[model samples]
Target chain A: MELFAYPFMLRALAGALIIGLAAPALGIYLVQRRLSLIGDGIGHVALTGVGVGLLTNNSPVLTAVVVATIGAVGVELIRERGRTSGDLALALLFYGGIAGGVVLVGLSDDKGNSNLMQYLFGSLITTSPQDIVVIGGLAAAVLAAMLLLRPALFALCNDEEYARVSGLPVRTLNILLAVTTAVTVTIAMRTVGLLLVSALMVVPVAAAQQVTRGFRTTMAAAMLIGLASAGLGVVVSAEADTAPGATTVLMALVAFLGATIGGMIRRNLRRRHNRPPVTTEPPDVVLHG
Target chain B: MSMSVVEVRHLAAGYDGREILRDVSLSVSPGDVVAVLGANGSGKSTLIRTILGLVPLSRGEIELFGTPQPRFRQWARIGYVPQRLGAGSGVPATVGEVVASGRLARRGIFRLPGAADRTAVREALTDVGLLDRINDPVATLSGGQQQRTLIARALAGKPDLLVLDEPNAGVDAASQEAFAAALTRFAGNGGTIVLVLHELGPLRPLIGRTVVVHDGRIAHEGPPPEPAGHHAEPDHDHVHPHADEVKAGICEWAPTEGAKSY
Candidate 1:
């Protein structure tokens, strides 16, 4: 009751809820593309964006949106060019992003030390009216973009080569995914911070995948898990005096573990009851690049 | 000869300038089930991908349905199935939805699927004999059924030209037969096919012509080779050494005194 009494708490809760819904919705495509770590990659890259904003006396959140979008594009390019290099390309971008941020913040000013910590740890007390507006606008945009591009995006996610042959603009759609992921992380950082935002994007999705067979169902399940985790974490952190971002991410992990165990139990029961096979026969694995 | 479905002249293509396809030239006419045969890495896949504009050609001309590659836009006229449908192809959607997506180029993205689109999807599934499994997630399908789903997806588009890269690769025998039947039905309706293949398998009878690719060049372009006795057993999955020699027999059959157009 005391927590709801404050306007700032209300704003923070609102912001967290928006991100909770938006992250996993956007995450559906990324996970399908096998670019799950891209959220963290963009999250780390946004640090440099934040540092640049502080130095330029501009809005750090806005700067994060810009820099991370470009960084997401960079990851897409590297991914395209370095398919043979495997995770080496992703590793380079991930480390380069965080290391670049640390050096930039270190050189900007001594006062930037706390701004750095605030971005990394997520200072819930600092949720301003302006933050809520930006978060809301971006969340709505992300959601609508996903809806409009659903068919084309689904084709690309299902198979890039097939999509290309089908005449979908493969490169443009890949860029669209990168841009949305960037914005997803920027808005998500408002609630979950830079470090744990990736977990918010992916963990709920992992859990959703365990129980759902269809893509739409998996996406809906993930969004629900994300909202539940985010809402509960915010409330729990308020009462327990814990870090909101870390707590929310931890809750998502708990849900994933629960889903995994529950899935295992169901599989065993199916075996005992002699039900039809859950999935199709052994997937015919093919090796072609 | 009726303005051939696909025409490639002196097409040279490769990844990163390594040149996997060297001065390759081929043409497919309507209602022709032309099989592009090759050993692994011999550029058969590259040749088909080049025609579809998936691969860039460095120094040649590719005209799809008479429109040059770059200026061509009616992608709905062509249906393509690549060599691999690897485990849900990395995303799992329902069979009907997956088949419906084949209509994207035809129906466009902004509007919802129409009655025609639905009919196309249903008929495609029926053609593949997977109409009953339309609501199931593609992941819940067996290997053969999944390939059938992909075939249904291609069929739903109702393309005049169908380009498949190794339709039989890594798929179960049941799927291979289903795919062959679907192709047969498509051919009956006047669809032209350009297939990339290693072994003809059950599809041997459908192939009207065979073009063999070797070391980035067209080794043979003529009558489908004899059903190498090696594969006569139906159960032998491996291409035996004698069969390889028979497939490679094109070299001696060349008309120009071993000038390489075997």
Candidate 2:
């Protein structure tokens, strides 16, 4: 109750809730497409955007959104081209992002280095009302696109060739997924930090799939897990005086371990129940050869 | 404006500037079961892929259902099954979910699946004899069952023409029979078919014609290649060496040890 009394805590909770739903929402497709690391890559790119914002004395969130979008699109295009050098190209881009961010911050001012820690590890003190608005608007957009295009995105991620033959706009959808991934990273940066943003995007989905049977159920369960982890992590971190992002990711991992054990037990029980009865007697319907 | 169901003229295409299909011309009329046969790395897969607009063509043109491929927008009229060994990706999906994707082109992107889409998916599953396994995850099914799921996905579209690449490779005998039966029914209903094959198996009887590709050219195109004597045995299970002989429709008919014609 005391936590809700603070306006800053309220904003942090609201942002976390929005991100809890949105991250894994788009994350399902990324995982399905086997591009789970893409979120991480985009997050790294957002760090450079953050640096750009600090250098220009502009809104870091806005600059990160713009710069990360371009970076995401560039990565998508290279992936589409699929040259042998594509792997090397993406590696360079990812490394360049972190290096660029740190160098830019160092050049900006001594204060910028201190500010960088807040972005890198995430700080509850920085949860401004403006950041909440940006997070809400962008997260809402990501959620809407992901839900409305579920069928199309599922088909594409499940079987890309078939999706193409089935007349879905494969290229457009691929690019759109890239852009949304960028948007999600920027929105989640303040809550989970740039370095740990992909954990929220991926860990919940991984946890959900352990016990779930189908894509739809896995996605639904992941969002719920994400929501719980985000809410719980924020409250606990405030009490324990720890970094919220690290705590949130740890919560998701805990859920993953629980789901894995639960699923194993369930499978064992079903196998035992379905096991055929053992008998030493010969079958009555047996025929001599 | 051509009357052919599929028309490819002098198609030169391959991956990465390496030409696999050279001066390949083929035409299919309505209700024709045309098998494109070749050895491993013979570019048979490349040929069909080129027709489907998957591989970029270096030269020539492809027309599907009388319209130029680039101009062809009636994708709902054609169903395609790629050379997939199994179904289901890193994500979990049921047989019903995978097959329902076949209706995407028919219904378009914005609209959700209605009653008609669901019925078509059910009917397609029935045709593959996989109606019971509709709710099961595709990963749980055997390789053959997954192949049937892919077939059912294509059939669910109700396409006028079906294109499959290696539909029987690595599939079990039972699934092959089911696939043949489904193709029979589709053909009986006046659907055109173009499939890539290494060995016809149960589909041998259904293939009206065969096009043999050798080093990226159509070497032979006529009546289906009849298996030589004991080579046609149902359970020999040999890998079938001698790709050249098979391409020429004349097998040495070597009977592996203890194999018989019955």
Candidate 3:
């Protein structure tokens, strides 16, 4: 297909590969911690950031990064303030952010900016070299952070209180994690858009978790699943002339469902094969009621 | 002649605004096994929480190893096993990983585990009789096994003092015996222990002293009485059916006012 012949297509493919790898690495931790929706919440915040940047004639990526970072820190602060659940907090912030972005976009006089829709829903074919570089840098930083903080992340996922008691400086680690999430969400927004970014964040990890038992194995599986989804989604989009972002998310969804069903079937087969003979008497029989 | 490992002088602590423990005082010398006994809601857990620096002390002061409790760095010297191990459902971890986390305070934030840390973890697991099940997921373990894993986690730190809140609650008889034996070994090794317990039947013999807390205060404090063999019923005006063995040469008549029945 000579897909790499075009510079823009090459950049787009490289960007997708880098993001697909980094997102799941970060997403595995977020999903395990039940903060999968934080990506969606912060990505929506990035939309408002893009609108603000566009209105001000500034770089949208920079604005998005700044806004996403602020939004991530705000989310962590809100979580610390009260007993409100993380999902509820994310939902509230997401709605508020989308409303603000919608209002900002509507108020803008730039009616002829047809590319704005691409930013909203993603246009991988039109990805620039700058986007590729930004995504690559972000992916490298995220991978490094994940490698260095694997143990802390494990502690955070398993037992945060234990992490804190162990003198892990849990508050600082949490803030660092949120900052990484912000960067990942902001960069991934270029491929999956704001609303659909969480799908990419959660689906690969969910699918991987269904098949893998260990933490390292699950993370590896998730990264592989994400890369497959991104690559297949790009190819399908090219052949069928569809939106790459939506195609990628749909592919991830399919993988998730397939893995879930496969896991269930495997479990059922194992149960049947390992079944013991039935007992006439109950295992726990008390003399008195 | 060394100072007591932990000393709580007239400490009052609680959650949010309401006070749960009022003017409770206790001290634990090195190698002492002090049991804080009381009915539920009598502030036994609150006392442990206060000592561990989990709860704020509303009144009075606490000294750990002869130092005031405000210092954060010294927290590494103390170990804690909360009541609920494997808290709630969906806790995805193995017993070894959970126990290894106890060394976090000693390891600090940036550094990874060293050879010594792994050795301590292995020893702790062996001490708790969970060495064989190190790789088993904590959620899949029985209640007693989970508790032992928690104890192993605490022991991994090799703390000078171990504070446990209701470690024996809801544990099976076998696990209870194992836990008691572990505590005895810990005490023999010159490690101090402070625990909150309800139903001290299985643990009564191991405990050196019992401190009864009532209405957030220290109601009684003395060495636990020796285990008297099964006693025949004494003809008394008010005979309590549950009175099997008396301890400390003190017979406590059931309180008439605000006394909660077990």
Candidate 4:
């Protein structure tokens, strides 16, 4: 109860709750499309944006949103063109982004490496009022788009060619999804940190899928799982003196393990209960002349 | 005379820069079951893809329901069942959910699904004998069941022309029979169909016409070819000879200017 006593903890919890719900909501589509690592790629790109902001003495989150969005579009375009494999292109963008961040940050005279650490591993305690406001607005937009575009996005991710022949704007929607992913990455940076942000996007979905039979249920369960992992992880870390981002990700992994075991047990029980009556009989083979 | 349901003229299309199909022209009327037969890499899939606008034509035009492909916006009037399940194997989607997505074009993207959408989904599943497994994840279904789910997905749209790409490829005999039954019902309702098939199998009775693609050209178009006695085995691999090299040679004559002439 006293965990919410501190103003910074309260801010951290608020940011956590927003990202907890938004990341998995958008993440289910990425998981469906088999692009789970894309969030990590965008996260790497957001680091360069942070460096840009520090160098220009501007807000890092804003710059990160812009830079990461461009990176996301570039990656999506390359993947769409099919000239190169998706992972290969992401690797190129990933290395380029991190190296660019290091060079740009080294050139700046600000608080140097320590500031980047806050973005990389998350500094939930240092979340400013401005950070919360921006994160809230962007997260709300992401959630709204995910809800409004659920059918289209599901169809696109489910069967792109079918979606195309069905007269959906496949390319435009692809670009929009890429942009939405970019926004989600930047919005989650302060809460989960750039390095660990993708964990929130992916692990909960994996966990939820272990027990859920449908996409909608999986998405809903994933969000609830994500919310618990983030909110409770923050509280537990604050009490135990651990990193909130790492704690949150670890909690998600624990949930995934639990779900997997539970699912296995449930399947076993169902199989036993519904087992068909076996009939042992001699083979009646038909011989041809 | 009723307008042709589908009219493809001089369609030349391929992947990358290579021409896979050249001078492919076909027409289908309402209540017709046209089977497109060909060998692997013989451009049968490419032809279907070109008709669906999944592949860009190097030359020629495609008209669906009398409307040019670029201008044709009535997608709900045409249903499609791709060769394989398009959704990746990793994602979890119920049979009902995937079939429900087929109604998206009818309802538009912004609006939520109404009672009509739900009813269509249920009926489609029932048509495929998958109503019992509506809540089950598609991943749990066998290959045949998955293909049936795709058929149901297309049927839920209630299209006038159902286009299927190898609907029975790798499917079990029972699933094929189920698919044939569904197609028979669709045809009974006056639905037109254009399908790409490797082997006629149970569908031979339903195919009113056959168009054979050999080396990217329509080598034969008429009544279905009577498979020789040796090739009469069920599920036999069908391969037509490449003796049509002369025809292929003629098609390559103006390859350089193929796109410009369109």
Candidate 5:
């Protein structure tokens, strides 16, 4: 009750909830499209944005959104040029953004800034009401975008070539996905930090997919799992005196493992149940032999 | 006579810089069942791809249903079934979902599927004899079942012309026969068909006309002469003896001369 009374805790909880809802919703499409690593890449881009914002004395969240969005578009453009796969392009963008951030941080005059560690490992206790508002608005935007682009996303996931032939604007959808991914990564950065945000975005959705057969069901399951992990991580962090971001990511990973094991057990049970009945008749000719 | 449903004149097509089809000209009329026969690497797939506006036409023109191919907006009138339905095709869809995809071109973006679309999907599944397994995962189905599902997907749009690329590849004899029957029914209902086939042993009887492509050109364009009255339906179901062993038999019958018009 005391923890709930604190404004910081309230802000942290709200931010985590928004990220938990939006990241997995966007991640469902990424997982289906086989570009799950893009989440990680965008997270690094957000880190770069944070570094730039800190140096310029600007709003880190705003800078994170802008930088990550540009990074997303850049990755998409590279993929469109047929130079690299989405995963590979994301990898290049991710490492480049991280390296740039490192250089920018080194050049900064504020060498003993404690905020740097907060950006790296995440800090739930430091979230302000403004941060919560930004995360909430971003989450709403992401959810709206996903709802509007569901059909196009479905077509793209099934077959891009077929989608083109079917009169879909594949390039536009690609750009949209990239943009939404950027927004998701930026918002998610506050929960798991830049280093491990992708885990929150991808793992829960992946685990949900193992159990759900349909696209809508999978998305719903992923959101549920993400929310559960985020809430559990917050409580555990408060109780154990650990870092909230790392604890959230670790909790998500544990959920994924649990889901995977449960899926395997269910599959094994189904196989056993579906097995054909064994014959009871003995080989009569063996006695004569 | 009315304009041909599909017209390709002096069309040249290829992937990258390597040309596989050169100076290919052909016109397909409505209700025509044209079999494109060729040895491997003989540009059959390229021709189909070119017609579908997938492969870029380097030279010449293509017209569909009296209009220039570029202006052919009636995609709902055309259906296509690719060579193979691999599990990795990223379709990870149910039979019903796969069939529903056929109506995508008909239903523009942002419009949810209505009752008519659902009826068409169900009818298509029924046409392919897969209504019982409409909810089954496509990956769990056998090769024949998967092929049937693809056919159902193409049929769901109720297209006037269906282009099938190697529909019978790797299928069992019974399934091949069943597929042939389905194609015959489709053509009998006045739908045009252009098929690319490597083995013409079983399908030879059902095809109305044959065009052999070789070295980026039509080597022969005429009615097939061997197995007289080949289009007649067979009475016996003997499992198509020597079907697998007849690969050598087909290679021996390859055209020895350049293309000759019928």
Candidate 6:
């Protein structure tokens, strides 16, 4: 009751809950597509966007969305062309982003490093009302996009080559995933911070996949796990006066371990029941003629 | 209405920039079970990929059901079973769900599956003889069952033409029998098939015509090779010694071009 009493805490909870639903929803596609690390890449580029916003006295969220989107589309293009090897292109952009963010934040000495720290580690204690609206709006967009392209995205993630032959626009669908990933990363950066954002995107999904049998079920379960971890992380951190972002990611990790263990136990039980009792009635051995 | 399901003229296609199908021509008429056979890297796979519009053509034309490749959009009418992609891994897919995806090309992206889609999916599973295991994870099935799942997925779309690439490679005898039975049923319904194969094996009886690709060119095209006692025994070894012929064929292209001619 007291946790939700503070306005800032309420705002933070709203943002976290929205992200809890949105991140893993998009993360399922990324994980299925085998591009789980793309979230990390987009988050890194988003840091530079934050730096630009700080330097220009504008909305960091807006800037981060733009910069990260461009980064994602660029990554998809390079991946499509496959001219250069490795994640060289993404790694370069990532390094450049962190460096640029550090320089710009250092230059903008208005509120000292604490101003940047909030975005870096998340500031559930100071979440403004405007922040809640933007996070909610971004969350709505991501969910709407997922609903609109669910089928095509499922087939694309299931098998890219097969989807192409199925007459789904593979290139456009690819761009859709990239753009959504970027958007998910940008908004999520505010709640879990760019450093631990993927914890919300990927970890819960990993946990859900361990327990669920089919893709759709895994997706739904991941969202529930994500919401629980993120919400609990926010409330617990608020009450305990700790970093919400780190605590949230820790909760997700714990959930993943729990899911993995639960899944293993279930599978072992099934194996035991399915197996016939160790039989000793093997006396009908074939005799050489 | 063109009775031909597929037509390719002087097709040249390969990965990236290099070409694999040097100058291959192929045509398949409705109700024909045509098999494209060749050894590894012989470009039989490339030939089928080119025809399906998966692999880009450097030079040549492809027409499916009377429409040019670029203009064709009735993907629902064409069933495709790609080579050796066992049922999805990591995230599990049910035999039913995988079969349902086949309906996506037909059902479009705007809505969920209706009654017709569900019926099609169920019927496809039954066609593959996996109706009882419709809810089972596809990965739990053996190698052959997985291939049948892929075939059933294609069948769910009620495609008039089926293009299968090495559907039997790595498949077990039982699974192959199931697959053959499914194909037989499909053929009985007047479905045309263009299959790329290493060898006809279980499918030998169903094949009406055989086209062998060597060095990216059509090496032979005629009535299905008299099934060699070992396979029209005359078809593979008797008619064409696979090894010596491949050596001669590769040597013809290898010395002048290079290894992996694309």
Q: What is the TM-score of each candidate against the true structure?
A: 0.89, 0.91, 0.85, 0.91, 0.85, 0.89
DockQ of each: 0.27, 0.30, 0.15, 0.29, 0.15, 0.25
Residue A167, model 6, lDDT: 88
- Give per-residue CA lDDT, model 5, range A155-190, as digits (tens): 677666666656567788899899989888887777
- B126: Cα error in model 4, Å: 1.2
Please give the distance, in angstroms, between residue B27's alpha carbon in candidate 5 and its true position after superposition. 1.8
Q: Write candidate 4's Cα lDDT for A1-289 as tens digits.
A: 7979989899999999899999999999999998898999999999999899989988888899999999999998998888448768779899999889877877777757788788898888899898889989999999999988888899999999999988888999999899999999998998889999899999999999888878889989999999999998899999999999999999999999999899878767766797642211111221223
TM-score of chain A of 5: 0.89
**In CAPRI terms, where does candidate 2 land?**
acceptable
lDDT of each: 0.81, 0.84, 0.76, 0.86, 0.76, 0.80
Of 1 and 4, which scores higher on DockQ?
4
Q: What is the DockQ of candidate 5?
A: 0.15
| DockQ of prediction 4 | 0.29
**For candidate 1, lDDT tens digit of each residue in A51-163?**
78777778888988899998899888888775788478778777887887787777775456677888887876689998888889988999888877888888888888878
Candidate 3, position B249, lDDT: 16
**Candidate 6, residues B1-262: lDDT per residue as tens digits?**
4557899999999987887889988888889999998889999988888887878889989999989999999998998998755325466557787778899889887778889999998888777777766776565555566677889889998999999998987665556777898899888888899899888777888989999999989999998766436644444544454646543432221111111111
Model 3, DockQ value? 0.15
Q: Fnat of the models, one by one?
A: 0.46, 0.48, 0.12, 0.56, 0.11, 0.39
Winner by DockQ between candidate 5 and candidate 1 = 1
- Model 2 alpha-carbon miss at residue A163, Å: 1.4
Residues A149-186, model 6: lDDT tens digits:
77778888887777877888889989988898889888
Lowest summed lDDT across 10 adjacent residues in model 4 chain B is found at: B253-262
**Residue B46 deviation, candidate 5, in Å?**
2.1
Per-residue alpha-carbon lDDT of candidate 3 for residues B1-262, written as tens digits (9 for 90 to 100):
4798888998999877899987988888988888998888999888887887767899999988888887756667778887765333232456777788788777765687889989999888877776766765555455666787889898998888888888877665456666787888888888888899886767777788989988999999999755344443354344455444432111132111111100
Docking class of 1: acceptable
- In candidate 4, stretches whose alpha carbon ends up further than 4 angstroms from where it belongs are A83-86, A274-289, B226-262
Model 5 chain A weakest 10-residue run by lDDT? A280-289
Q: C-alpha displacement of B154 in model 2, angstroms? A: 0.6
